[model samples]
Target: MPFASQPVRRVAAAEGIRASGHWPHTIPAVRQLLTDGLDLDPGVTFLVGENGAGKSTLVEAIAIAFGMSPEGGSTGARLTTRESESPLSRDLTLTRGAGSARWGFFLRAETMHGYYTYLEQNPGMRPDPQFHELSHGEGFLELLRSRFDSPGLYCLDEPESALSFSSSLALVGVLNELTAGGAQVLCATHSPVVCSLPGAAILEVGEWGIRRTTWEDLELVQNWKAYLQTPERYLRHVL
Candidate 1:
């Protein structure tokens, strides 16, 4: 498939703007994206890193630039409980594919409760899922199963936060379904189980910036393997 056929082919800083000694631009991955554009794959792309590494920042900017709400939801959604989103979206530019679907969704884990309430307040033609009644993990899975059936750009920020091991696997399955239907997925995650999606592009985000890597070679996976092999070895430091 042609690169332009995907929802978003590339991401870079807007013309005439330079990465400064600012909040988000100080993030190495964001700086790299601004200096040298990052090309997105046609299918699933996973961003993995530690906390405060700007994975969520990049994902949020991409989603906002693609017209999704800062909180979470579809393109038309306007849910906002607070004004805490970074100012990176305004300075970022998304190079969308030539004939890709403009329809997209942003699944922000932190503000999903607000998004659910927003859905209830503004009922659509279709019946909204009872997101409140379900448990946290169940709600995430249900939302993925129901809302993620469409073909478009789906940016998920730390979706595994509310998911268990089995649910994480199920999330990967839903991602597979989306990719099969020509939809694209950009996810920032920490779960080794979640990022282990076969053939999914894995980008390590950190002080070194974003670098394309493999599942076996990922620091997250290696650390998980080490910790699992001997929990005491890792627990000793923080126990």
Candidate 2:
């Protein structure tokens, strides 16, 4: 993969918005991040947060701001199945490093089924073996291997939704290769496996606001570690 254009360097909400009634403004993480802005890692930037922490909202906004479909697929992918996207994209400002991104894709776990269906209906867009034919994890991997061959920006939301532990590890490799090939990846995920990429920037979203953090410091990783160390402690209570 060669550089078609420079990757996105930063993303922030445009200044001077009335925050009284906005949906994003009401979300603590979104509000703080929008005001403070985020400087992305040229290689990889991972967004880690608990459920309802606005991770998906932020990632979706970035994808839309970059002109990718609010659903899933590359900028050229025009398959629109619904109009459920938030209005945050309209208020975002993206700063480019030097060149422009020639290729980009937005991959969201929830809407992948619909995206695959769209491809099936449009034969020209359908890949070999058809995306729907494969298992969820397999289909996602195939898409990454085949469609993500070029260097560009990729925004993914909860990509681990369907991936098994092994598949998530494989994704780590795919993402590592993409970054090394001049691509930039911004992902929102809960899987420790996916977020374990070496040298990547990890940002934790919470009530305190978006700030730089380490993989070890992430609450998700901490909880996972605790569980792995003693599953019976949690299972005892839940079961």
Candidate 3:
């Protein structure tokens, strides 16, 4: 479990985007992130944002820049369908720590089915029970147990998309273990459960750009708290 104190220290957008005329510039959040470099925690860094806030865009770009597949899998798993990745990976610079990662995976909830198919086709790469054969949440847990056995970097996008509340809590536990084992995790999520991991660095993304914040300060967390406190108050309108 012993590893370097930090794997990836920071990620910064290189200058010359204006001249490069890349598509990332078109997205306001991306432009803002490019302007202000992002500092990563050695353990866990959670990227929290509303839809279209560019969290996924930034996470995917980081995964690609770190040499992982865009479709979401291990670096060895070269799975791709169509090229929808932004050029941001090519422009961004990743600063590593004293040591390099020995293992890593990029898990995008939306494309996990594709990753499972790839694994099924390649039995050697497939874990026991087969990823596709298991339920969505089960597959994610299995990946965490098996693929994340070593100290490495992990990038995840909305991993709680298919998970229930209990399952999200289970993931939080797994993440706690992973970080304790010296893994660095970058997750883009809307799940309050996933964001509530103690001591995790939370970066809130919005039209105003990204800023370091706490779980209590996040609008998503605040709304969830209010709704949970008085579901009747909000549900009355919807119902």
Candidate 1 — which residues are off by over 4 angstroms?
1-3
Stretches > 4 Å off in candidate 2? 1-5, 123-127
lDDT tens string, model 1, 5-104? 8999989899998999999899999999999989999999999999999999999999999999999999999888889999999998888898899999
lDDT for position 205 in model 2: 85
Arrange candidates by TM-score, descending: 1, 2, 3
Question: After superposition on all CA atoms, what RMSD does each candidate show versus the true structure?
Answer: 1.1, 2.9, 2.9
lDDT-based ranking, best first? 1, 2, 3
The segments of candidate 3 whose C-alpha lies over 4 angstroms from its true place after superposition are 1-5, 18-22, 125-127, 236-239
> What are the models' TM-scores?
0.97, 0.92, 0.90
Best by TM-score: 1
Candidate 1 residue 57 Cα shift, in angstroms, is 0.3
- Which residue pairs in model 1 clash with each other? none
